[model samples]
Target: MSCVQTFADYGFRALGIGERALPKTDITLCEQVVLIGSGMFWNIYFALLALLLGFVAASLVAFARNSTRAILWRPAAIFIFILRGSPLFLQFFLIYETFVLLPKVGFDLNLGFVDITVETRWLTRAWLGALIVLFLNTTAYTAQIFYGALRSVPKGEIEAALAMGMTPNQINRRIIWPTMLRLAWPSYTNEAIFLFHATALVFFSSFPAWQQKGDALYYASYFADKTFNPFVPYPIIAVFFIAFTLLIILIFGFFQRRLNRHL
Candidate 1:
């Protein structure tokens, strides 16, 4: 088939939106590129949502850990230590197993006013389950980054804020948070890149890709196995990722520039 036809056929195969059967024989370069590109959608999906959610959670955790109160900081310290210390692959396996062991029939939450039936089955799926793992993992790593940045925030700045008659809330919202973000952002950008690359682990982990709808590495592996050639498909995957990584750097670099504009 022509490259255009190949693109049309496999462009969205990863989403189960296009051709159902993967190319078994005579898989061309166009087919590999298109299908692998299609699978990239999932990688982007997992990375974007995980980073967005993780950022907020990390910020809160950072604040908790930075607090002088032992009650607040102890649990946060333990959480960061556990997640940052453990291997991400093992975390994925353990979390998936934990989800699988939950009652499949679902459970009821007895809220004061009403009962809410919470389903457990969905947590076993890659979309949600792997997402949770990535979210928590990134949160732990990023919280540490933010916490370190929080510590590095100049004490003189805090004193200056106090001198300006700023309330604690105002001081945090105005002086502390922005400075923390500015200091933490460069490191966070690297974390974001790592997280996006890490999304390739979803299908390889215990979390199965429902149907054939897997990530770029999933489809790349398929082509490599079929053709008995690791070269073509894997490089295609690398190229696609490299391009996207550059895009990420550009986007994050824009925000970095904005944050440092005052300097």
Candidate 2:
């Protein structure tokens, strides 16, 4: 069967869709390609959402780190240091354990006139927990990128804005931020590609892959175990990853062009 038909038979089978059982004795190259490509769907989902949301948070943290007050600057500095200094692999393990210890029934909040219960157990699972870790991790890395760009913003640009009676916020919004993003685009692009590759570490960390459904790396590992041939499935996965990385570069290259349009 063609890869498309193989996917049709088993794509969502990871989530119990068309096939009740995965391939056993007769696993073929086509099946490996289709299933691994299907798993890439989840990897893209996680990376895209985390990067989009984390970019805003990172910019704010970068701004706070550059603030005049010691109170604002100190915490931001320490947060960036702690996150960047430690191994992300360790962070994933620690966070998963911490989330697992929380009350299964969740915590209750008492407003003046109302009570609310927030569920915390779902965080112990791979999906939510891994997403949270990746989000915070990328935010810290991107914040440092933004911070460096913030420092490199031309002093004359700010002075000119002030001379024109531009308020502080207006100067930042209109002049400083855009330029910083433009200057930081190349390094930021590298960070983004690395973060997507890092999603492979999720299953290997403390978070459990519920129901055997997992990312591309997880399935690649499974096939390697069954067939005892690292050559076929793993190389197929690497090609998929290479294609995915190229797609990211293409998308971000378009943004880089827009950022540098006037230059």
Candidate 3:
């Protein structure tokens, strides 16, 4: 088939939207490129959602870790310790197996007006299960970065805010939080890059891709296994990841400039 036709056929195969069967025989360069490019959508999806949700959770955890109360800080510290201490690949396997062991019927919630049954079966799928792992892992990592930045916020600025008769809330909102973000952003940018690159791990994890809808690495592996030539397909994966990583840098760099614009 022509390249354009190949693209039309397999362009979105990774999403379960296109052809049911991947090109099994007589695979062409066009087929590999198009299918692999299509598979990148999952990597982007995992990274984008994880980073967005993880950022909010990390911010909250950072504040908790910074709190003087042991009740707040201790749990936060332990959470960060556990997540950061463990290997992500192991976390994926454990979480997936745990989810599998849960009762298939899932938990039922009772309210005066009605009852709701939350499903557990969905947790075995990569879309939701792998996502939860990524979210928690990044949250632990990013929370530490933010906590350090929070600690590094200049004491002089706090004193100035106090002298200005700013309330604690006002000081935090105006002086502390903004400065923490600013100080943390450079390192956070690195974390974001790492998280994006880490999305590739989802394919290898215990979370199963439904209907053969896998990520870029998944398709690359498929092509390599079929063709028995690692040189071609594996490099394609690297090239695609490198290009996407650069795009991530450009996007994050724009925000980095904005954060440091005053300096």
For lDDT, the strongest prediction is 1
Evaluated at residue 76, the lDDT of candidate 1 is 100
lDDT order, best first, reads 1, 3, 2
lDDT tens string, model 1, 79-181?
A: 9999999999999999999999888886889998999987889899888999999999999999999999999999999999999999999999999999999
What stretches of model 2 exceed 4 Å from their correct place? 1-4, 14-16, 106-118
Model 2 residue pairs with clashes: none
lDDT score at residue 78, model 3, on the 0-100 scale: 100
Clashing pairs in 3: none
Off by over 4 Å in 3: 106-118
lDDT of each: 0.94, 0.88, 0.92
Clashes of 2: 0
TM-score of each: 0.95, 0.93, 0.94
